[model samples]
Target: MSDINISKLDAASADFDRKLQKLLAWNEADDRHIQQTVLDIIADVRTKGDKAVIDYTNRFDQRHISAAGELELPGEILKSAWESLPAEQAQALQIAAKRIRAYAERQKIESWQYTEVDGTLLGQKITPLDRAGLYVPGGKAAYPSSVLMNAVPAKVAGVGELIMVVPAPKGETNQLVLAAAYLAGVDRAFAVGGAQAIAALAYGTETIPAVAKIVGPGNIYVATAKKFVFGRVGIDMIAGPSEILIICDGGTNADWIAMDLFSQAEHDENAQAILISQDESFLKAVEQSIHKLLPQMERARIISASLSARGALIKVNNLNEAVDIANIIAPEHLELSVEDPEILGKNIRHAGAIFMGRYTAEVIGDYCAGPNHVLPTSGTARFSSPLGVYDFQKRSSLINCSQTGAETLGKTASLLARGESLTAHARSAEYRLKA
Candidate 1:
């Protein structure tokens, strides 16, 4: 194999920031045409109900189902899928499910209230969504991990019903995905996908029930449809390609670093894996290690393409410089593979998920590290976060005013209402005050 020539940049260079910006820029404008297509599909589902879902499933997934009822899988099928799994696979699934559930349990929100001296009760009441739609990528690439990540949290949040949609191209379905659904406590599983599936979930068909929110990752069409139906139904996030930014202090193994970079790159041609270090020699060594290891990877072509297109081997004056650059990028995954990762991690302000220390491989976090792998990407870690039980829960403010409390608060409310020229509101407050 030829030597991989990923982009090289020095943090001290004058044009470093400009070059970095260019690298980070993803052209979302090019997909404007998909919006109209998604809107049309959403309208079709809304109008024709189950019939539209059937038509789209038949056309896109090459299925022969004539009735919408056929799209919904039986609960027994999900249970059987779990039962038929090999012992190792089932054990792994159970282990991962247990860990994920344990973590999600910690994130569950509880209702709370307190009464004030004036007998005014104000607090928050927490409740889970009535139903949630989980989209799992099906077809050739099955993400059983995704099913676990998206479903377990909703279940932990006490969501009443969970509906899952996965594309079964040519009437084929993935058993592991099905098993995952069973293990995650999904109420219903459907063999449908793409923008049509999202639309059906957003706007309830006769067969498929509308959900309060939708959460999962999919192709651009699925993402576009999610964006269009966002107001009608909540979506977890409009995710971008996977990303990982590793900061090494020239202390870890070069081969380990190379494999870590390859982990995200093998995800797709657009996925990014960058390594930052203060030791220029270490960077060169890691690049050599990448060249040696790329030939052995199963997805070498994809890894090569991603590395060539978006991956980088960056050099900085010191570890502090690396942290500063990391904050600017706000990667989906940041690995502090340093001597004292905990100390270095204190400075990290952004990153969807941080894999601290050299021993914590990012792959573990993707599967069984007890955290949701559904993370923000394309530099969105600057604001967003990883998926959790909180996403499936809602908080409603509680306000109960006693007679004395109402009269005491009424004067302030009247003043504010009158200041805003809301005479009706002022009069309403005045009426409460007098009574």
Candidate 2:
């Protein structure tokens, strides 16, 4: 394979900030045409319901379904798919599901209340959504791991039901995805996808139930549809291309670091993979390894394009400088491949998920490592987080006041409301006050 020209940067460069911002920039701006198309699809689904979903599925996925009933996959089919998987695949799926579920269990929020001296009960009631929808990219691209990552969390959160939708283009369905869904406790599965599936999940077709929240990843159309349906139903996030930033201390194997960068770059042409190291020679060694390994990759072209477009290798003065750069970039996956990762991790202020130590490859976190692989991307990690059980739960403030407590709080409320010129609010508070 020819040498790949990944970007090289120095923290001490005179225009380092300018160059860094350029590398980190990703435009997720809405396209007017796509937005209009998604709006039209959503409107159609809302108006025609089952017929619209069926029509869209048939047209988009090349399926010849005569009825909406045919769109819903039977539970028995999912079970059979799980039963039919190869022993190795089945065991791997089980392991991954178990790990994901165990991690999700810890993230579950419970209802709690505390009584104050005035006999006023104030706390929070954590409740799961009634139902959630999971969208897995289907057809030629299969992601069984996505099923486990998304469904496991909602199930752990005690979401009443979990519905999944995947498009089977050309009447082709991925058995692994079906098997994973069955294992992950998906209550329902549908053979439909794209913006139409998002529409069905958001508005509820005759055959599909409206989900309280939607989670998982999808293509551009699906993402745009999610944006359009935000007010109608809760959404996990509008994810950007996969990203990984590795801060290494020149000690780990260069080949390992190269492969780690390859993992995210292989996701798509736009995916970003970056490495920052205080040792300049280590960065060169990884670059050499990248060239050596590129030819062996099945998705070499995609990886190469990704690395050329957005990937980088940076020279930092020290680990502290690396941490500073990492916070600014706020990548979806941050790897501290150093001797003392825990110490370095303490200074990290941003990142969707942090993979600590030389042995903790970011890929482990993608599957059986127990953390949700679905993460905020395009520097959004500064503000957002990974998909977890908390994403599936809703919190309601709990307030119960005794008569005396009400009287005491009412005076403050009445004064505040009256000052704000909300007469009805002030009057309501006055009614609760002792006469």
- Per-model root-mean-square deviation over C-alphas: 1.0, 1.0
Mark the 10 consecutive residues where model 1 has the least summed lDDT: 24-33
TM-score of each: 0.98, 0.98
| Model 1 backbone overlap count | 0
lDDT of each: 0.94, 0.94
Superposition TM-score, candidate 1 onto the true structure? 0.98
Residue-by-residue lDDT tens digits, candidate 1, 318-415 = 99999999999999999999999988899999899999998988999999999989999988888999999999999999999998899989899999
| lDDT of prediction 1 | 0.94
How many backbone clashes does every candidate have? 0, 0
